[model samples]
Target: MPDDDYDDDRDDETRRPARRRRGPRNNTDVPCPECGARSVRPGPWPWYLGTIGAMVCRAVICEECGHEYDERKPHAHLPTRKRNLAIVINLLGFVGIVSVFVLLGVWIYFTMGRR
Candidate 1:
């Protein structure tokens, strides 16, 4: 590629800065843990997965107090519960199926050889 074609200044205008959303932010006015002030701002989003669900939340930090809090705490226990139930039900079904086969083999062994 040509050197002039890859100019930094030309790409500067094309790359727009990320715009911060305007809204009634939750936990924004919460007091910081470090400074005990309400000058907290939204920080980067934290990604985590738990037994209940996957969690992704923007971190809030107090500018004056230096406290941090999570903004998103989506509950995912319903899906987790359903998944556990499905696994248990499937395991029971497999056990029942294997028992049926075993019973049939025993019955055949007792009846077929005598005849």
Candidate 2:
């Protein structure tokens, strides 16, 4: 029972930071409203997109019947089709600009030789 016999290791110990654990908020096991089959998938975006938008929009789709739904309030659907159309239009615009520059370069190249 001597004070010197106890090592002061308790005071030297560093405090560990508290770890924040995330828990699942919704029950994913719930049956699909459209189809009673458990083949329904949960998450945002379609299954083809790998469900990346699950964080922004909690969406669900029933594979058995091709039914789509969102459980989260104020849910937003992905504008994939619109985005694709925009991309195509932008690409065409870019090609047109480049084509114009190429045409101008060719015109100058030929005209300068004559001058």
Candidate 3:
């Protein structure tokens, strides 16, 4: 009789330890954009380090839509402004050359008439 009680107590203690070690269940349910099915997987890390500890995120491409999005530093517009200024300077130089030729032609014509 005492042996039976000891066996019952041992079973209860083992079941209690099992219940205490129980963990929560994981639920990861998401649909995939490519096939419209529930088969989504974890994506890889996409980041790169630039100058001065600056990090840039890589592009995210959509498999279903075939679209790509890039992330980078924007280029400065100083080069374009310098090019426009050079064009304007060249245009002014051409106009000045034309004016000099016209003035020389008029000066020669007037001098020949005086002779």
- Global Cα RMSD, each model: 10.6, 10.7, 21.0
Residue-by-residue lDDT tens digits, candidate 2, 6-105: 5455444545566898542334555556655445555445453332344434566666676665545313343644345446656777999999999999
Off by over 4 Å in 1: 1-76
lDDT agreement of model 1 with the native: 0.54
lDDT of 2: 0.56
Candidate 2 residues lying further than 4 Å off, grouped into runs, are 1-78
What's the TM-score of each model vs. the native?
Answer: 0.34, 0.33, 0.33
Q: Give residue 38's lDDT in candidate 1 (0 to 100).
A: 51
Q: Per-residue CA lDDT of candidate 1, range 25-58, in tens?
A: 3445445455555555765432222322223333
Candidate 2 TM-score, true structure as reference: 0.33
Q: lDDT of all the models against the reference?
A: 0.54, 0.56, 0.45
Candidate 1 lDDT for residue 106: 96
Residue 42 shift from truth in candidate 2, angstroms: 29
Q: After superposition, how far is residue 30 of candidate 2 from its true place, in Å?
A: 31
Model 2: lowest-lDDT 10 consecutive positions: 73-82
